[model samples]
Target: MLNVALFDKTAKEWREENKDLKGNMRDYASLNELLVLANMESFNAILIEKGLEQKERMIELRKLARNQMLSLEKLNKGNLKQLEDKKK
Candidate 1:
């Protein structure tokens, strides 16, 4: 039985180590999704915990998520600017 807490802790640690993240700290969904991305390091790390692989691939899905978030932020900002422009 894979204890979700272990991964949860790992994800929390990653978040804490990466100070750039802002907002709610409890990101269970993100962590679980990261583990699902076998191409990423998070899956490798989790697998290594069980000696499932000789070499773990650190995929780091969080980085991708962050990139997406940044893109969304930019898009929203651009929209807001357009709204302001329209108002003027």
Candidate 2:
């Protein structure tokens, strides 16, 4: 699961560790890299905190992504079932 809390915590740690840095560009870039890596590693489900300005939009996107995932899962299952039936 892609927990926002965990990301937040990790970002904070990175910020703290890089407090002497002059700009926030590096911090944000590092966070983006980490997120990309996590996604590539098969992380799913994002948990965000409440009161976010774009909460509704984020929720909608999440739902859409989840539905797509479900659809893909169903498709794979159907293909597997067909393969098994053919073998039998």
Candidate 3:
């Protein structure tokens, strides 16, 4: 479910698409993606303890993943720009 929320595909789907790959989709995930997955796992536990339904939890996790990824991308670009400016 978390995989679906973040990557829009399940492990089985990824496997089907990458037959020659050595590992799962997560093995190829970016640093930011790994971070978000960890965070989602934690959040999912809390949501489960709260008795939230699977559908509701999926929606919440998707929103969280999207927002966090967008913020990370913006921050990374800003840092990269700063580094380029410093090299000038």
Candidate 4:
């Protein structure tokens, strides 16, 4: 089960902290960028909770996090392309 609250809080915090870097929320690129940062922070917190002894798990988590970010980027690009096509 995914924790919606945790991700929402992380996303809000990221928005608050990076107000200067923020782009319009309606834009797919901007929205995806925010989500990626939020996910990274959430994953970092989970990694910290796992502690140092879980070396193998930590490595796996890092890879998972990277893949998740890349996936989000690809999805955002695809979504934007679709939107552009619709606008044509």
Question: Model 2, 49: alpha-carbon shift in Å?
Answer: 24
Tens digit of per-residue lDDT, candidate 1, span 25-87: 445345434344333445546667766634222233344444555665677799999999999
The positional error of residue 83 in candidate 1, measured at the CA in angstroms, is 0.4
Comparing 1 and 3 by lDDT, which wins? 3
**lDDT of candidate 4 at residue 4, scale 0 to 100:** 22
Per-residue CA lDDT of candidate 2, range 35-84, in tens? 44355234223333333344553454455445555666677799999999
Sequence-dependent TM-score of model 1? 0.37
For model 2, the superposed segments whose C-alpha errors exceed 4 Å read: 1-53
- Which candidate number maximizes TM-score? 3
Ranking by lDDT: 3, 4, 2, 1
The runs of at least 3 residues in candidate 3 whose Cα sits more than 4 Å from the true structure, single-residue gaps closed, are none
Positional deviation of residue 39's Cα in model 3 after best superposition, in angstroms = 0.3
Q: What is the TM-score of each candidate against the true structure?
A: 0.37, 0.40, 0.98, 0.43
lDDT of the candidates, in the order given: 0.49, 0.49, 0.98, 0.56
Residue pairs with colliding backbones in model 3 are none
Model 4, position 78: C-alpha lDDT score: 96
Q: How does candidate 2 fare on TM-score?
A: 0.40
Model 4 alpha-carbon miss at residue 79, Å: 0.1
